[model samples]
Target: MGRWTGWVRWGALGAAVVVLVVFLVAQRQSIDVSYGRSPSSSGTVEEGSAGELSDATVPSVDEMTAMVAADPVVRLPGSIAHWDEGLVRNAIGDADVRILVAPPGLDKDERGRVRDVDNAQLRVLGTEVTGSIYQAAADDLPSWRAQFATGDVTSLLVTLIAGIRDQDTPEDVDLFRWRPPTEAETAAIATDLRATGVHIADGATLTDIPKSAGPAFPDGGALYAAFPQQTFGEPVPEYGPTLAALFPGKPIVVIYGSWIEYHGPNAADFTDVVGASFYGQAADRISTYDYPQANVLHAYLNRVTDVRYAGLFERPLPYLPLDPLRVALPALPWLFAGCVVVFLALSARSLLGPRRGVRSTGPPARLAGLTALAIEMSGLTDEKSDPALTRGITKLRAAGDALEQNLPDGHVGKLLDDAEAELDDTAWTLGRNDYRPFTYLRGRLA
Candidate 1:
């Protein structure tokens, strides 16, 4: 039974360990995301790897006023903003927008923060349900904005963001260049993010968006007209693939970044592009364009050959939120092994039982019964008894002798016989101690 108990404990622990391992392995991708943020500030913002984006700027938002142009939907990230919270909220609530909470690290830097803020607002055109693709330029966002703008997006809105870095690195061609993304370019970006060990939404992928400042996605419309009162944060980094998956056919409205504030003192015609679609105080607040970061460098590269251009950066640092074991699967066997050891260590008490000394006396049941019998014999023998009795007593004892053979394992007969002999010798008188050893004798024999 003891050996059986040990095996049971070990088996239980082993099973638990295996179960934990399987659960963790299944969540590997989620775990990878928690580690996305880089501690120090030093990164690059290069040209994107997809479509040429610099050449396309057709009927900029400003130029298309009063025009009801409809065609097969274009791809774009979906988000909208408004100056007044009440207005933006009421409007987008019905139009197409489910605001998502910002991750902590995002709200910190206003510059980088704005891209996310503006991008979130784009949900009006409905990036939420339609998949918003996140594109970055270089390691930043110039590429996403630059190239995305080149593509026609009458239906989607893009979230452009960048993690923090020390230098813009503009002086070196290695730092920032204008380009578009090829099929290979897009695949490479997606692959790298995957290598980091993170799981993404079913249809989403990470593009590039560099870190930067306020109004990152500002439409020329009045603040209340487009963006809500909430401060801007980083936008999604992987929206292109997501959008394509969500609405296979739709126009994509590109509301990307321009360092120029759409509503600021020194704004550009592009601001009107942001404003054109984002009119109305309630549900129609469009998107904004304000840039401090860069867009997907790979997408930016692709934009070089695109018909139009729009680039921005806005993803928060450290993208996904999963535990370590769930993310890094290769390390699983060792971790589960450790857990098995811990489970075994805690089970020793139950496996060994009370005899182990640290606990109460859980001695064998048979041995305990014998000890009780010995105590009873010692007490009975202490009672006074006259051995120098008449012939009648002696004869009576002899008459019952044959019946004594049937006594049990720890019978008192042997002790009683010894005590009788001692008593017979003592006769007239004697202390109880004289017969005590006699009882001990019988006990030993038994």
Candidate 2:
């Protein structure tokens, strides 16, 4: 029983070791959990409040419609304009603009601050470069209306787009929420982006914008913003994945003769930073020469398109080279812990099993009898001898010669032990046979 118990314990121990090895390899291949939050906040929008609309601040759908219909240039809410000043200033440039904020109810503070200015829920409505007006707004208006309590603001947002669509504006409306970091939120965001295969250098500045909702053509397959005269670091391949990861379904806006600007951490060095773009002195030449007629880089939407929006989707989406460790993540550590415990328990059992002295190193004791048997039969011969028996006797003689070298205990020792058993059987058979002098034994005596 104890012998069987030892065997069971060793088997269990071997299984535990194998399990540990497999789990360790999985851990290495797994992506980091640090980038747990998705780069894009674009998702299902919540329903708007049904409470009475604020007559003082909230514009009725008709009023908003009329406002956009009357003029092409209008100022945005202070709360909204802060996202990206350049977006409203240069990108839009007095074109009729229509905006949509998710969870449509807009509340004003005593200081007139708009409280519902979240990046995930806000959208700027625009048409194609060919002057295609509010077509995008028409498609999304129903969804927007479903979220509103009155649908009046929805009408206003829709009408705003319709007005832009009717106008022959030369520029498309674009705006982003750009700001300098007053806290570590930006740094934490940058860290998260890095884990998703984005290469962010030390002291490099990072600012992100939410996905854009527009009907622009799929240019380079993504959307990015270009700030004037703001050339950032050298444009690395990581920028596409990083940007796509952040703004999954948006296009990367490119400005001719410009690059993104990065600043030092110090406030005095113009620490105000927002958006990402290619960097380096070479960027100056590239942007100036090659990008002058560049169209927007179109990207896949987080929900509307595949997750590999800007990624090299050589493999399945889940197996992205840098995919995060999301598989069995909550249970992996526990499994490893369990394996370790099992391994320890099995080790303990092995330690408690019967103790033995150091392994013997010389030839097995049975080698002497085997050698004697081989010598006695070496030169003996008989015409009626079985061919198999003759071969066996020859092999045994060779084993006997090899055994004299004092081979250390190991595989050689094990092989010699087998030889001994074979030789002993042969010797017993020979003793039972009617042997004749100077001849090998005949069959056992009948």
Candidate 3:
């Protein structure tokens, strides 16, 4: 086809796609849907009135242990505690492996604080996360940070744990961590590290572990977040499926951006902390543990039978600008619509497909195996065999080469080559039968 004709057809299709996009944009403006909570509190309800309506006191590690004991099988992540309490406690049967990742540490810059405030304001100490977990405690952050700085406080907390449920996949696990710790703030950093069981550097004193140079570990601990498929040092966005693929039937543990919490017990405010969802569907999967949860990470060697969302560090992967379709289209139905359009456009382009570029303007070329027998068994060449015969011969020679590579040891390949050679000879003979007629197609081609 001419270039002008191709452009005209393409322009028409382009206009249609634009119309669809515009219609979707307008439709999106009319309604909005999001995976989790909007940062705004203008219209939101409180989540997690689970357990009891008792006083909301910060839980102690011992109390956290008792709570875990209540379960039939408390599955832990390699990122949790250093050992499997299930094997240590309840290992007979009914072991439900509830996978989880390390919780996030709190760290937000002005850009993050501004984004949440001007947009959703969903961050810790900035908006609803503050209101939900520590509406009462947030006011005392300075005191807490100071208490943390004291270096004398044995245990510390921000009191942000609450009811988490899933709005998307109920089976999906959820996690929330809006805070982290500096070396001194933990006070018992040595004990905490031991709980995670990450090896302390050999020949190094406890003072060497947190003396500012970095944790003096020998080869890093077993709790070092062993990859279910530890191909990526930090959890990356694209690693979700790759992790799933590697683990197969086991669950998926996602640590958004591999936040700071992976290094130690503490850090601060992150953007996509999973537990912030008052409405995030996966809230029911949220699990909390005292510092002892490090055993979960220890289970990484067991192939991580459970999957979890640990917002440790809470630093979300850089928010990918949502696709125009995901943000605005009638996606589900639009999928069918898109398929229909694509099929039609392809079909139209095919049926009306340009003819000049056609490799052969005739019936399919002959299979080499059939050619030799056909040449010997039938009219070797008709009066008009030149063009068709030439094309078929060319195709047969190609098939022979393809056959050689594809079936080097096979008997069929040898047969195919032999047949092709016979056919080519017959075709050559026929093609040589020429006529003088200038206009007769058979003679003209010859």
Candidate 4:
């Protein structure tokens, strides 16, 4: 009985261990951390092919803004500072937009500029230029300043970029005399931009800027060629058509090295128009202008443009809160170890603890008697005159009789009676010098 009880206990423990192992293996499989890394900071720009502008009617800035705001994903360039709190609110409206910020490399003075922002529907990831913003969305990992709301980070990136650019440049250049990036430089910049996850239609420079109400700039200058109109801040209708053709269906970002007034009448036609100028003027305009910095003409242009082109890239996935299972995973091994220790302790206690005396019962006594009878019957010799054989037979008969009497008066009693009868017959056969019956009875008893 004790041996059977031990088997049952061990069987249950083994089953539990198997279940724990299976669960642990499943948990390990479910854990995935295969996020892609940022592209290397190599590659030079070399000009390639150019395409003709399509006559597709460009959406107005308001229309483009609405469209971008309605999209599931919107990718914007520049830091959080370029975005206005109210504009972000209006753009995102009721829907949740996960705003990821990958600022340029920071200097000591620019570090605090990327501080956490406040917005409930938005999650801000502080400056991580090498980190893939798309990966952050795809993996659903927590952001750097995940606690801050979207509004809290408003203009933070813009301000930081502006300040950093200002610090880097000792003097400002004349916008008219500024030398445009060469074809090779444009190609290299395009390559760098592509690494940041923005899709560049092709590595080509604008061959021509169609007719518009602006002065004609030198042709073959990638961005400058698109803006054939006078360098003075004015809407160049040709700019839109030229850009539309050069980079069809993609959001156009007009990046300028320094602050320049690029906003014009058809400015909204582009996805986003950004330059160091937009960020530099954001702070001063905040007090001069009643609206948020993003709502301002140039800032609005930048915002609307970003929204319009947001579709070209993957929509950033919302930031997922810290998982309870993930939090517990680190401690799971310790927990399992503790469980094993407890199990071992209990097993040891069971093995070493005081044992209770087993009371002798009728069934066990009868079983023992049966075993003794079988042994005595096997020892009987094939000699009828042998006194020792007679004594053994007598002992077997006594044991069988005692077992039969102790057994209950049911099927058990019947089976015992039959066995006793068989034993007696075997004893009689042995006495008559017939050993076959004795051997058969001994086999049956075994």
Per-prediction tally of clashes:
153, 27, 53, 18
Q: After superposing candidate 3, which stretches have Cα over 4 Å from the reference?
A: 1-188, 191-272, 277-282, 285-446
Q: Model 1: how far is 303 from its true place, Å?
A: 13
Best by TM-score: 2
Better of 1 and 2 by lDDT: 2
Shift of residue 43 alpha carbon in model 1, Å: 28
lDDT of 3 by residue, 1-446 (tens): 22333455566567567756676555644543333222221222233222211122323334334434464322222222122233322221242322111221212232232223221111221111322222212122322222111111111111222221111211211122133334453334334334653323222212212211111111233122211211211222233234333334322322321111122212123212322221132111222211112222222211111111121333232223557755655554465466557656655744643211112212123242244435443455564444444544555566556655664423443443344433433443454322101112222223
Per-residue error (Å), model 3, residue 444:
11
RMSD of each: 23.2, 21.0, 23.9, 21.8
lDDT of 1 by residue, 251-286 (tens): 212223221112232123433443322221111111
lDDT of 4 by residue, 1-446 (tens): 12333454566566557656755774754543322221112232221111111122222335434544565333333332223445435434454443434223233223232222212123233222211122111111011111111212233332233333333312221112233445564555455434542222242222222222011111112232121112232222222233434444443433221122322223443222332323433432222112211123334243333332332223232234677765766666665566566567556735553221122334344445544555665666445324433443454455456555764534443444344434433454455422323344344444
By how many angstroms RMSD does model 3 differ from the true structure?
23.9
Against the true structure, whose lDDT is highest?
Answer: 4
lDDT score, candidate 3:
0.29
**lDDT of candidates 1 onward, in order:** 0.30, 0.33, 0.29, 0.34
Please report, as a residue range, the 10-residue window in candidate 4 with the lowest summed lDDT: 138-147
